[model samples]
Target: MSTLAPPVRRTLALTKANARLLVRNRTTFLYALVMPLVPMVIVFASGGASDAAGANAVTSVLLMAVLFPVFYNVLSQVVTRRDELVLKRLRTGEVTDREIALSIALPGVAIALAVAVVTVPVSLVAGLPLPSNPAVYLLGALVSSVVFAALAFWTAAWTRNAEAGQMTSVPVMVLAVAGTLVAAVPDRVAQVLEATPGGAMYELVRTGWYGAGGVGDAVEPLVVLAAWGVVAVSLARRSMRWEPRV
Candidate 1:
């Protein structure tokens, strides 16, 4: 008798299904794709000459790209799925909670990566300096994605419904955006902001863009990001509901 596929394969199939839904949904299209492109077009056209300015602009846009898929999209989708009883039904299947969560998260992560890839060439064409250390820049972007994904899951745990998710997601989104924009101000305040998840990500990416020395330099921001992820994952596991909240 034929047997069902392994959990990994099933998760991949679920990812594809989720991705299809993402593409068809008009609201998802607005936030995930169109939103990032709007700022990108403006930045690309305005054009900064200095490397520092260019790096800041490029990183800002990248952060915006990261925000939608990793934070907004993931939170909205997860909460909606739970509200609709999809998560409860999926729990009866062979797929573990981890698999279910990952499958749900896959579309956003994939879109974020795709945006990062395309943004690189476009930024270069727009006259921004290419990251001096391409590998490190990519690493920073990947870490940011993971960190934000965890944050999304954590935030969704408290979010009551799809509409509530929009309100709930704002604080984290504001923190992330504000951190990048304020990263340049010199003082203890900047230092404090640097400790935030968004700030840590901004510093890491900016450092990489400048081709800074050994990875040792990045240890602090990496540690901060990892700490946030740990906390988020713990909270998500404890609080995230499989059934609709009542």
Candidate 2:
């Protein structure tokens, strides 16, 4: 008679199993843990504690943390499990569909959260200024993780296999990175890009973490991110496949 709800217990069990599998995959595990730290190298090399540098560093860290661990890893796991018939088998069990999907997603989401937590201390050690709005920064990270995870499921809907993920993942990856470069683009184009998922992420960092503007300034980006998350989740629910694409 466990005190935990049945769903929680089942989801936890599934998550533990999935986490073990992820750990056994040395390549992906290493990528999820190490790749996000790569941006720290750039921050160090630049040798500047300027506001712009700090903002860029924070943005890059958040982006990398979510992109690989939360987004790509989830995409890969979903595709692999579906192809292996693991998802299909799970569906025949006591676990619900949402539980199965969440279990697959939880491991990556945990890793992303760990990285986000480590980032603050690392930033201080690197001589970057503390985020003026730590609450917003953390909220942004949470939103980013959920948004990317949903996007991964949507992407996995069409992904044939883990190998095909490499090609299929490019568009979303590009969209994410493109947002961080909005400052370099023309104003008109930047406006459009700002509405994109990546663009919204950058905006959150700009107004929330960097404190470039007031709380009101953070509203638009938050709304943009929320919209993306809703859309991605809806699409995933509709299109996600339990069986491998033949």
Candidate 3:
């Protein structure tokens, strides 16, 4: 019988409003939820051929899929709020900038987590096995979510409008997917991919799920992920705008 703290409550309110706005935009909602999953659905519909890659590959792809909705949805929140003058009013409140950023990200994180949960059982039935190391899988997913959300906030600062924001996010989404696409290549190429932002995490989660080991195994990817985290947060803090874009 405990109530949510003020910050958490505020975050929830922001998320709820953002969701309502999304639902009202039918086309955007459709694209938000559907586009990223096209690859997954196509693979699964083909009788889970690529799905045989193991739990790590399946979960990695699914986590990457969450990026489509989370980044765009959160970026759209910042852009739309600026247009509505809601962001301007928020600046006058006692709310901290970090809190504001978290509130904006709150909805997308929830959605991603829900998708992670829902996708697990469905993935198994589709031929991808359950993750052998669930903790590592969940940790990688969690880290990926925060990294993307922070990156979205960082981008939203430069965005002049919703269209501009959408366009800007395209590169990031491309980078993330391209980074993970290393799985389709040879081991040497994949080793290179393991150093890129999402690539390392993909390999990390995959190996961890499949129970691989070595001293440097966790070090490289963890370093890369942490570096991205620092970069994303610093950019957001340095550039976030509270006033209207105009």
Candidate 4:
């Protein structure tokens, strides 16, 4: 018998199968692979001369990576599989709900991480300063990926179909983008935005990559992200659909 835990084995198998399907859908795969890198144009355009500019560029790239590859992709895949009865059938088997969802989400998560890894070298090559605290930067990337993945699953619950994902995904995207614009917003609004996922992520990138503040400054954003993750997971568990919405 395989020594690996049953959940791990099942999740790995499902992830492999899903990854194959993702690759076969050349359009989605291409978007996942390519879209995250588009914001690097910011780095090059600004000449990456200042620490603040480097942090902004990296934040933009990471946010785009999580938004499209992790959040949107997972939302589309989950909705499509549910509509197709794939998730329904899988639920009838030995796989647990958590395993199934994790499996479905893993590929996109991997893509987001790959983009993060590439960002380091790309930042270096672009004349950007090194991260002041690599640990905080890494934690931010990992937590952001999880938070967005959970949000995607929650969003998938209401999505009518894969086609509807584009429309359904807009609110979160807007929130994420708005978080990045804190500098442009009023102080009261910026405070509220800072508590949002995008705002927290932007703060993390700034603190982590540019030494904007010490690790102490990461506490609030980390807490905000943790709260969002908890809420999103709870909602997804309560509302996630197995069969089509009908």
Best by TM-score: 4
Error of 2 at 119 (Å): 1.4
Worst 10 residues of 1 by lDDT: 46-55
Error of 1 at 80 (Å): 0.9
Local distance difference test, per candidate?
A: 0.78, 0.85, 0.68, 0.88
lDDT of 4 by residue, 1-246 (tens): 899998899999999999998889988888788899999888776554666566667888989999988998899899999998999899899999989999988999999988888888788777787788888988998899999999999999999988888899999899787788766688999899999898898899988887787999998899999999999999999999999997
Top candidate (lDDT) = 4
TM-score of each predicted structure versus truth: 0.92, 0.95, 0.84, 0.96
> Which ten-residue region of model 4 has the weakest summed lDDT?
45-54
User: What does candidate 1's lDDT look like per residue over 1-246, in tens digits?
Assistant: 436668878889889988888888998868888776666774586366655566567667668777897778889889989999999999998889998889888888777777777777888788776777677677777777887888898899889999998799888888787776544788778888888877777677667766556566777888888888888888888988888888
TM-score order, best first, reads 4, 2, 1, 3
lDDT of 2 by residue, 156-209 (tens): 999998999999999999988888777778999999999987788778777776
Error of 1 at 128 (Å): 1.4
Off by over 4 Å in 3: 1-3, 42-60, 186-188, 214-219
For model 4, what is the alpha-carbon lDDT of residue 148? Answer: 95
lDDT of 3 by residue, 83-157 (tens): 778888877887667677777776667666666666667666666656666666666666777888888888888
How much is the lDDT of residue 35 in candidate 2? 88
